[model samples]
Target: MPKITYIEHNGTEHVVEVPVGLTVMEGARDNNIPGIEADCGGACACSTCHVYIDPAWVEKLPAKEDMEEDMLDFAYQPDPARSRLTCQIKVTEDMEGLVVQMPEKQI
Candidate 1:
């Protein structure tokens, strides 16, 4: 399992241990962390799971695919350098201590 820290817009943090292979979106939902709506249930079709990866951990994640990049266009406040759909970030052992900050809104 890998531990992920989700920080809300207000600076509240929720640390959760997520099983490898699960998406970060799933981890947040399973942990009952707020601000990750995951309205599409892990599907890459929506931006409700938008989050900004901590700069320190950004390079560790795989590059976003075309679908993910397109969906990000719909995110509330997308940041090309940091915004990502949580559903596209799969958990891995090396991802322990990963941190992501939720956007102020998700649409």
Candidate 2:
């Protein structure tokens, strides 16, 4: 399992271990983390699971696909260089130290 750190907008953090093959949004949802809503159930159809990747981890994640990029247009405040839709990122051992910060609010 890879450990993922989810940070809330208010600066609180939750570090949880997610099994390999699960999506990042699923890790948050399963652990009851407060930030990622996952409204589309990992379908990449909504921006509610939007988050900002920690600067150091930004280049480590897979590039966003067209669908995820389009949906992020509806997120609260997306950063072109850091914003990512959690549902699109599958967990793997290489992401053990991954960190993601929630926006102030989701759309």
Candidate 3:
């Protein structure tokens, strides 16, 4: 299992051991973490699962595709350098201990 840490707006952190092949949003959703809603079910159609990749680990993640980039345009608190849809990031052994910073809002 890979571990993921989600840091919330108020600086609270929730960590979960996520199974490989699951998306980060799924990890958060399954663990009852409060920040991700996954409104489009990982389809890249919504930005409800938006999150910020920790700066230190940003380069390790897969680059955003066109669809993800488009949807990110609608994210509530978008930051081109750090924002990403959690659904687009799959859990993997190499990604164990991934840390994500959640925005203050996700509408």
Candidate 4:
């Protein structure tokens, strides 16, 4: 399992032990962490699960695919350099200690 840290807009942090195969959005939801709506159930069709990867971990993630990039257009405050759909990020062993920040709004 990998541990992922989710920071809310107010600086609240939730550190969850996520299984290696689950998506980041699923990890947050399963652990009762707020801010990740995942309205589309981990599909790339929605932006409610949008989050900002911590600067240090940004380069460790895979490049965004076309669908993810298009969906981000609907995120609350899109930052191309950091905004990513949590559903698209898989929890891998190498992602241990990964940190992601939630946006102020999800709609």
Candidate 5:
């Protein structure tokens, strides 16, 4: 399991251990973390699972695919440099210590 940190807009932090092969959204969902809704259930069909990757971890994550980039347009407050759909970020050993911050709201 790899540990991931999810920070709410108000600054609450939840650090969780996620199994490899699951998406970052799944980790948050399973832990009852409130920030990511994952409304499309990891299908890349909605922007509900949006979060801002911490600047330190941005370049470490996989680059966004066209589908993810497109869906992010619908997110509430997207930052081109850090915004990402958690559903598209699969957990891996290399992702340990990954940190993400939730937006003010999901749209």
Candidate 6:
């Protein structure tokens, strides 16, 4: 299992253990993390799971695919360098202790 930390705008954080091979969104959804709605269910079609990668860990994540990039354009409060759809971020051993910040809103 990998540990993932989701932080809210108010500085609240939720840390959950996620099984390897699941998406970050799944972890959030399973743990009842407040910010990630994951409305599209990891299909890469919606921005409801939008989050901002911590600057230090941004480069550690794999590059976003074209479809994900396109979807991110619709994210609420998008940040050019850090915004990402949590559904696209698969949990992996390398991602142990991953930390992500939720946006103020998700459209």
Candidate 6 C-alpha lDDT tens digits along 1-107: 98889999788999889999999999999888998888888899899999999998899999999999999989987998999999998888999878999998889
Task: Give the C-alpha lDDT of model 5.
Answer: 0.96
RMSD, every candidate, angstroms: 0.5, 0.5, 0.7, 0.5, 0.5, 0.7
What does candidate 3's lDDT look like per residue over 1-107, in tens digits? 98889999899999889999999999999999997888888888889999999998889999998999999999997989999999998888999889998888888
Candidate 4 local lDDT, 1-107, one digit each (tens): 98999999899999989999999999999999999999999978889999999999989999999999999999998998999999999889999999999999898
Per-residue lDDT of 18 in model 3: 95
Candidate 4, which segments miss by more than 4 Å at Cα?
none
Error of 5 at 25 (Å): 0.3
lDDT of 6 at 23: 92
Model 4 / residue 66 / CA error / Å: 0.3
Question: Which 10-residue span in candidate 5 carries the lowest summed lDDT?
Answer: 34-43
Which tens-of-lDDT digit does each residue in 1-107 have in candidate 5? Answer: 99999999999999999999999999999999997999889999999999999999999998999999999999998999999999999999999899999999999
State the displacement of the C-alpha of residue 37, model 3, in Å, after optimal TM-score superposition: 1.0
Model 3 has an lDDT value of 0.91
Error of 5 at 66 (Å): 0.3
lDDT of each: 0.95, 0.94, 0.91, 0.94, 0.96, 0.91
Off by over 4 Å in 1: none
Angstrom error of the Cα, residue 79, model 2: value is 0.4
Best by lDDT: 5
Model 5: residues with Cα > 4 Å off, grouped in runs: none
